[model samples]
Target: MKKITVLIVLASFFSCTSTKIIVDRPIVFNDEREALTLEYLENRYGLVQNTPTIVPKMIVLHWTVIPTFEKSFEAFDNPTLPNWRPEIKDISGLNVSSQFMIDRDGTIYRLLPETTMARHVIGLNHCAIGIENVGGTEKLPLTKAQLKSNIWLVRYLKDKYDIDYLIGHYEYTLFENHPLWLERDDGYRTKKTDPGQYFMQKVRDAVSDLNFKPLPNED
Candidate 1:
């Protein structure tokens, strides 16, 4: 139960600014995970670095699709992919993870350090910070509380970093050949629909004042 507290100034739904909290419920990022991260960075992004770190330029949001917070947490807590996820296991044993995760009740949890490189997105893991939500299946759509929390996180990260983009998981493919896309394998892409359009749009609208750069299709 190691924890670190962060106090962020958030824009309330009614346009007033208030302080909000982000809890640090860390997952296992031991020596083994760090080694995998470094190897993945070098092999995937052509970055041969001694330490696995990323200068975040974007924020990508995702939904767990696995109902409970504990289950979703467990999924990303490991350093290697589990046996059940055979489709992506061979791609590199590094498990998928995000820097932040939100529970259905709008509880924001930090799964990893914001600056660390996480294997959440396809091509932009080298420069994007990820935020995952607890639920987004047809059985359990993302909740309003989650939307508000996401909006808050987007603003917080934008203020803390030089973030140039805010995107949903599905929009990741749009950056395929753009300057930031760094995946060497052209065929290593996968279709995604986590944290759907409506949810993304709501979060976008709430933080529209931030003026994040347009997605590839928007221009």
Candidate 2:
């Protein structure tokens, strides 16, 4: 019975994969938040959709830079932006979040539904799923365990959806000219360097066989 229960849960959203996803959906997605997401999509992406869902074309990797899993989760669990993030508050109150969060120990936590539009990225939030790692500072770089888990999670998501590109948060700007790029305000961009280069290379190499499409500016 226990085995059957687990299988049922997996069948709902994901395909058969070794990656264990722990659902810790503390981020509020009530009527107000949903309304805000819809407004963001229409205003930012020029998409007047009745829902705030995405088609899942890309997978974005990020590092929280917060040094601990609890603090990182708290940062995103709120419905609206906190006071410190005034730099981006002028854009939208919808707090930044991701579909998945990986702890330093490689424990995978699902913060929101995979198709929900998270404000983690600027130009591609309409169609990209974000994966946030717990720590990304130079003093607390992403761990080996997190790397292994990210590789597995990437493959699992690729097989489950029509994912075409895998990218680190820093590389999102490269898609500015691509058709999938949808941010209306060109000047509303912020620099990012999360889930660093070495970490990205390792994960990409692990899933090399998946043949994800190249970035728009990749040489």
Candidate 3:
């Protein structure tokens, strides 16, 4: 009897948490940062065009420790990274900015228009749509409102762009061995824990219809 009771409790707990674990769709809030353009996308980040060009295949989620939408907007607009983003220097003159930024109140801002190669992630810019969320501190973990907005955005992008994969920023390294890996320095990789794993799962579940590319089988 005790065993059965424990199992039931576990199932209940999991059921309650499951909904919070992953996003069901992409965010679709108003593009507060629409003025940001493709030229800024290129110059802010010294990105070189890859031959054959990359397709819009992945949607990556991120978080800006910096609070507020305007601050995040300014951060993406500038070509130089603030002293905070040491990761920016490794990519040469290339700055770190996503195609989209989600504010604290679940406001979605478009720093750059869709399909344009922004320097949000190295090697995957040609193909990935970056979405950065504001406020990632323990006290300010992403909110449920943000999660719902993310789902809306995912669905919107999936319909609009030929998006294949939806992932969190931390999973970027997992693609190192995959065909998408294009950096000259294969050894050069950054460690990240943005937008949280649980948060990503929520996004993936919401946009599962997009059908992410299957990771190649091990050699």
Per-residue error (Å), model 1, residue 182: 0.3
What tens digits encode model 3's per-residue C-alpha lDDT throughout 1-219? 111111111112212432222222222212332223233334433344433134688888899878776676667666554576676564454446777777777666666556655666655666788888988888889888788768767766676677767778877776775776565566557778998988988887766656777544323
Candidate 3 global CA lDDT score: 0.63
- lDDT, candidates in the order shown: 0.89, 0.86, 0.63
lDDT for each residue of candidate 1 in 1-219, tens digit (9 for 90 to 100): 656676555544446686778888888899999999999998888999988899999999999998999999999999998999887777789888999999999999999999988999988999999999998999899998999889888988888899999999999989987999999998888889988999999989988988899988555
TM-score of structure candidate 3: 0.71
Candidate whose lDDT is highest: 1
TM-scores of all candidate predictions against the true structure = 0.94, 0.91, 0.71
Candidate order by decreasing TM-score = 1, 2, 3
- How far in Å is the alpha carbon of 212 misplaced in model 3? 2.4
**lDDT of model 1 at residue 87?**
76
